[model samples]
Target: MSIKNTIKNWVLCSALLAALPITVTAGNKAEIGVVKDFKVTSQLASRDQAVRMFEGEFFRDPYIYLGPDDYYYLTGTRRHHLSGGSKKDWTSEGVELWRSKDLSSWELLAVPRRLGDLSWVDGLKAHSDEVGKGNARVWAPEIHFINDKWVIVHTTSVRKAMLYVADKAEGPYVETELSTTIDHKHDPSFFHDDDGKVYLTHRVDTVVEMTPDFNELTDNEFKVKPANRKMGHEGLYLTKVNDRYVIFGTAWSTDKIGRGSYNMYYATATDIRGPYSDRRYMGRFLGHGTPFQDREGQWWTTAFQNGKTMDFNTITKAKGLEKKKYTVFKDGIYLVPLELTVKSDGDVFFTPLDSRLVQPGPEEVQKF
Candidate 1:
């Protein structure tokens, strides 16, 4: 897909974000609202079947942020009331949190801060067009331990991205002074540098620095993009890999929303604000998953079921992407091992340890 077409599709996707991503036809072609009829072989389970196996853990744009005290905090866009909620419930309640010493077992924390409890409630209401009509749902909530405090940044379907801070990860959290600056950013996340500068990266390719007190933000002009093109549609995430700064973004394989597989692409640079390198394929169907390391230093990335699929053999035509590496799973969080290596030149080589997740699909638009 050309850059112009990609941008065109993005405009449509941004508006429909509060609705579940779905396709109309099911046959050989799977792009946007179109999917070729495919079969769910005995070895493969449908998306609905996969959701059942999760036992209420189903989430979208899942995040695993390792915090202080040897605990990794888990969070994402969970059902508002924890059951029977729409996947695209923009009116869903506020953030949910879980903590684990080992990723194998998780302990649900009490709701730190409900949507109504947000400190900037009145301001957010004045800003959102959906107020009183049931629309302000939270998505992609990420908590970071910065400056010895737990800071939370989340985006709502109503186009308000706000921040909250608490003394602890599980909090009676309160809104920050910066919360009033709701300028329509989505999938906002934090990157704390080694020297202690906290940067918020969002809006596809923009980054901004936060004041030490967390009360305000610098000019929102810093941008990070693949060497050649803009980063993927959304889910812009940043982390330091060794000495290199690795940034990841999510997109559909065809570079157009609703077509092909959901996937991740990444780039690396020596500087946090940088002339980054060309985009590289991270994994097919791994869009929006968070990358982190285990207690023993083994790396893994979070994966979830965002779409349904049948066996490739059932796919009469997948545009040659059927032959590419792939993995099918349900709508819950799973950690796939990562093979991360840094070269002598300081560029990072990051790929899934599982061979099935190594390449972009044939329908992928951008050539890395």
Candidate 2:
């Protein structure tokens, strides 16, 4: 209220104004721009950059086996750009082995021998003229650990399903001297039942009895296909759930030409060598990949959708299925989580799980 006090207050206010830019003049306003963080331009970009695992290559007919060391081992048909008019040029060399602990990150383990280099090639080629024929590439290799040794049942051509044995998962897998079991089978897969019976599914599912060493196959063989003729099947994989024998395979009718018809389907049966019924559609555009159960009992599949890393739930309803027409896109290998459920009356159904359940890793999110 005093004049001296008012003068002192005015001086203090003037000093404060000189120290700080309380008001910006027109000349300096242009210079007062934002200091943007070039590293993080947007929230979405930042989130994408946080991904750590990268998407892998096209692993067609991917067969992954859980090893004794608690690690997952994967081996598939080696793919190459086969450019030629003749099928002989389509032969691929070695099968690549990949190992991963969490299923999120994978590392290349080794490149095993080609089918042509197998020890029994001399005998097999002598017995069957088709052994060294066109496009006789090793295809759809399915690996399994049986009776203390590793066994790989694979197809050399559309005509031969041969067996290879090894002492280790990551192996120098040697071909057994035995002859081809199913000469006209493609994508041969072995399934060990809870009842301790190991059944191999080649084109038409067959119950095969292996020797104690798992190298030799006995004459114990039975047919499981005529049970369901409607199933124009390919990529057969037999899995036993509870008291049911479930065969998950692919059935695609390319009736609409360009609108490619490749879809994964499944059939169920009470007996292994069954009258397997209830042929149902699983997902469209899924390539010849196998269904596997994780450590936590979660069902998932690693298949290709247009060559990309494509995976979806085995039991979850497939998303974006409303599109009447479907074309197989060359997307890389995709790994998806699936939910498989069975009804009280013994019916089984699968739905592809929510996409939100899987997040892109660093390999997927490119960082500059």
Judging by TM-score against the true structure, name the best candidate. 1
lDDT of each: 0.66, 0.52
lDDT of 1 by residue, 249-318 (tens): 8877866566667788888888878889998888877888888776666566777765565464443345
Clash totals for all models, in order? 11, 32
Task: Locate the minimum summed-lDDT window of 10 residues in model 2.
Answer: 1-10
Task: Mark the regions of model 1 whose C-alpha exceeds 4 Å error after superposition.
Answer: 1-57, 83-91, 130-134, 312-327
Scored by lDDT, the top model is: 1
Instruction: Show model 2 residue runs off by greater than 4 Å.
Output: 1-58, 80-91, 122-135, 179-182, 225-229, 253-259, 306-329, 354-368
lDDT of 2 at 244: 75
Q: lDDT tens string, model 2, 220-300? A: 877665343544445667777777777776644332212233556677778877788756656555536577776656666
TM-score of each: 0.80, 0.67
Q: What is the lDDT of candidate 1?
A: 0.66
Work out how many backbone clashes candidate 1 has. 11
Q: Evaluate model 2: give its lDDT.
A: 0.52
